[model samples]
Target chain A: MAEMVFQRTKGLQDRPFHYCPGCTHGIIHRLVAEVLEELGVLDKAIGVAPVGCSVFAYDYFNCDMQEAAHGRAPAVATGIKRVHPDKVVFTYQGDGDLASIGTAEIVHAAMRGEKITTIFVNNAIYGMTGGQMAPTTLVGQKATTSPFGRDKNHAGSPIRMSEMLATLEGPAYIERVTVTTPAHIRKAKKAIRKAFEAQIEGKGFTMIEVLSTCPTNWGMSPVEALRWLEENMIPYYPLGVYKASEEVK
Target chain B: MAKVLMKGNEAIGAAAIKAGCKFFFGYPITPQSELPEYMAREMPKAGATFLQAESEVAAINMVYGAAGAGARVMTSSSSPGISLKQEGISYIAGAELPCVIVNIIRGGPGLGGIQPAQSDYFQATKGGGHGDYKMVVLAPASVQELTDLLMEGFDIADQYRNPVMIIGDGMLGQMMEPVELREPKKRNLPPKDWATTGTGGRGHTNVINSLFIDPAECEKHNLKLKAKFDEMEKNEKKYEIYNCDNPDIIVAAYGTTSRIVKTAIDKCKDEGINVGLIRPISLWPFPYEVFEEYADRAKAFLSVEMSLGQMVEDVKLGVNGKKPVYFYGRTGGMVPVPDDIVAEIKKILGGAK
Candidate 1:
């Protein structure tokens, strides 16, 4: 008999993913849950879901969860991590929840050196709010709100969250990875493990920015979305390690 | 527990510590800055946590996070800063997390003056944010009352699993008074079994949320919240009466204005006029029963406040049109003195505005 492998990760619940058919949030969530399960921190992980497409993450993640208001998940994660310093804490947020309204929250939380992990999914569009223009949307990209292409003169260019956040001295590790291909998905899982490892070692403020594809919001097929992500999103958001603290480095 | 002479802002800090608040998140704002400063200096020494957040929006969300994790937490700010916090407040209220908030109100419609004012009365008692929610609004009339109310405020928050606010003014915050701090009491309270503490070995994920997309679900949530508000109205009505045994006129006021109104009532008594006073301690509960007792017998009602009569609306509603209600107020950080209130009461009784 052939040995069996690749069983379902016990870190996630049996509930089906509620994301759009071709969106990569389900893939990203699987990577995170698999990493926590492999690290033996599944039951001890406290996840904070932001007010965007992944807002119902509490039902999907098989752990204690708290849903935060839009853009406020970092601050909420800070509060939770502060009270239980020994527990593993993470926040799953999208572009609109992190870069636009919660800019202050994410920046200040990073500056304070809060001991927690952040899984930032950048799809470059507001998937939960009817595909509105996001702060991470490419300059030429058209959104529901930006019916015409995004004008850099008026809307500004896409914000490089990992690059910008790495400039702060508080974070222990900061990396931007992609999940467009199988090789990239494996690398993305490795980055997610390193983020949680930093927290396990008591390193402060670790974050991983996963460049994901939103097929429904991007108005592309699954294959087209993956190709577009590699072609368009990767150039603006180059995938690599942006920052690593002295101990982690 | 010595009767030390301390500022009201400092007293509030001591009260919160006595109430077992293990964490504090706040930002600097006028008049109330001293309160956060007090927490910063004292919380660390007590082996607790203090974080000066980037903004009021960040501060309140920080409180939301801490409270969701089952820790007793608090935050403080002034008028403008509190306005910036309404978004987080609505979420915290909707999530049913227990916490304490302090609003050292000043004059305002936009960055109003830093002096004491009761202008935030409506904002505190009525819905300050965009929601159908309520907070147990506690208005303290003195520095001692500030300490007493906060001791009860933290418990009130924990008991109801809701947010409770102590809205004072710049005078109470800046003034110094003798206060004998209450010793810490381990009250018999229910455990926070529903908090998200990483689930432990419970084998069940505890979720803290308020979002319900379906209209029927949202309406059901609204009904559940409304029932809690109704319970608060039943059990939390609080007010104090001064010389109401038999009165021809009643003066309605709270916070700093209540002190001045008390003097005006005394002056009226000396002048052989039957003028009593009603000070609503729980502003949301409104203490309307006090008005029901005197509305039938009193000749009229006078609502005096430091703002342009914000609390007057509640006073009229409490009176329920049984007697003609009069309002005399000063705005823009101006306080009406005892003589001014007495003059207004006399003119009103004399059938004048």
Candidate 2:
């Protein structure tokens, strides 16, 4: 008898996710699932799914999940974590959801030192809503809402979330990583794991902001999208640990 | 148990911590402002979360977030501040999340006053937000009861998977009295299997949500809520009957005003007039059955309030027009004294000097 080795993440069924082709959300989702599986905390964990392409994340993560109003995942996660501090709590949010609509919630959650992990995906442009410029959108990146390219004169510059959040002393750990290739994906996984580990260790507010590619929104092929993230987005975003106690030396 | 002098609002805050409610989100609002102030000092000692939210809206949503995660949570505000929380409260109710909301009500119709008033009776009883939802409304007439009811409010909220509201007047929130709190029971909430903890091999992710686009699905959810409410009405209706033995008149009141009415009933009895007091503990079910029973025996009923006739209408309906229900209230931050209520009770008794 052949060893049966095929199963989608236990909580996430095998349905095709709603993310656009070449969008890195699916990869991030898989990474999160793998971490949950590896830690043996899947049944004891709960994820707050954000509104965006990842709105259907509840269907993909086998653990108990909840959908938050746009950008309010952090606040919701705070609630869930406080009620069941023994349970691991996390929120999956997009650039628009976290940086735009959910700005106050995430900031206050961090300020309060909530013992939760946040997986913030910074894809430069809004993927689910069709190519609109996001708070994290690069200055020269042309989005549907910024057809003339993002103008610093009017639209303001891209927000460096990790840098800004790092300035605050609330978070126990903060890091930025990319998922452009297999090696980068491996590194991204390590950072993601570290963020969750911080939460498990009773550290407060660890966030891993993944610099991802939105091929459909950027009007590029998957290859070009990855290349574009490397050439343009990474230069502005700078993939590395902006703040971590281990990196203090 | 020995009684200790305590303000109603302060007692609620202490009782909540004793009840294992470790998270409290609130903004400063008059009358009930002491609640958050108390929690700010108490929560840290208990290893709890106490945050002064940017606004009442944010505070309530914070409670919503925490409660959704299956944590024991609470919030307190005055009438105007509670008005700001209506949106979040509606969302909480729609999602059937368990939590506690305390409204130390003031005169209202809009920023009416900072003094005590029962003007929010309609809002508390009839779902204060834009949905067909009901909160288990608990009205406390004394500081001791406020402490006890707040603990009960948390249990009932968790039991029914809905928000429970403790509605009091400003006087109830500010006034002090001796109270003896019972030892809290251990919280036995089943592991929040549905909370958004990282999935540890659970068959499916549990989702807490209020959005249902499909009409049939929405209707089904509404019916489930209605069934729970019907059960609550049958099992959770609570009221206290005082001097009901062969009384000529019954006075319907609650919260701070009820205590005043008690004093007035004593005065009326001294003057050779018989007046009974029906004080509702669970105000949402409104103790209609009790009113119906009293209506058959009494000559007339008078609804005493600190606001303009809000609960009087409910009393009239509860009596089903069997007796004339008259309303006498002092609005805009004014708390009518026992003498004022006694005068009204005498007038209703028709020239009983």
DockQ of each: 0.85, 0.47
Candidates' C-alpha lDDT: 0.90, 0.85
Q: Which stretches of candidate 2 lie over 4 Å from their true place?
A: A1-11, A83-87, A123-159, A178-184, A211-239, A246-249, B25-27, B40-71, B107-113, B183-206, B211-213, B243-249, B267-274, B298-300, B342-353
DockQ of 2: 0.47
Off by over 4 Å in 1: A1-4, B183-188
What are the per-residue Cα lDDT tens digits for candidate 2 across A111-223? 77788899999998888888899988888779999999999989999888889888877788889999999999999999989888888888778899998988888989999
lDDT of 1 by residue, A76-192 (tens): 998898888989999999989999999999999899888899999999999988999999999989999898989999999899999999999999999999998899999999999
Best by DockQ: 1
Docking class of 2: acceptable
- Model 2 chain B: weakest 10-residue lDDT segment is B195-204
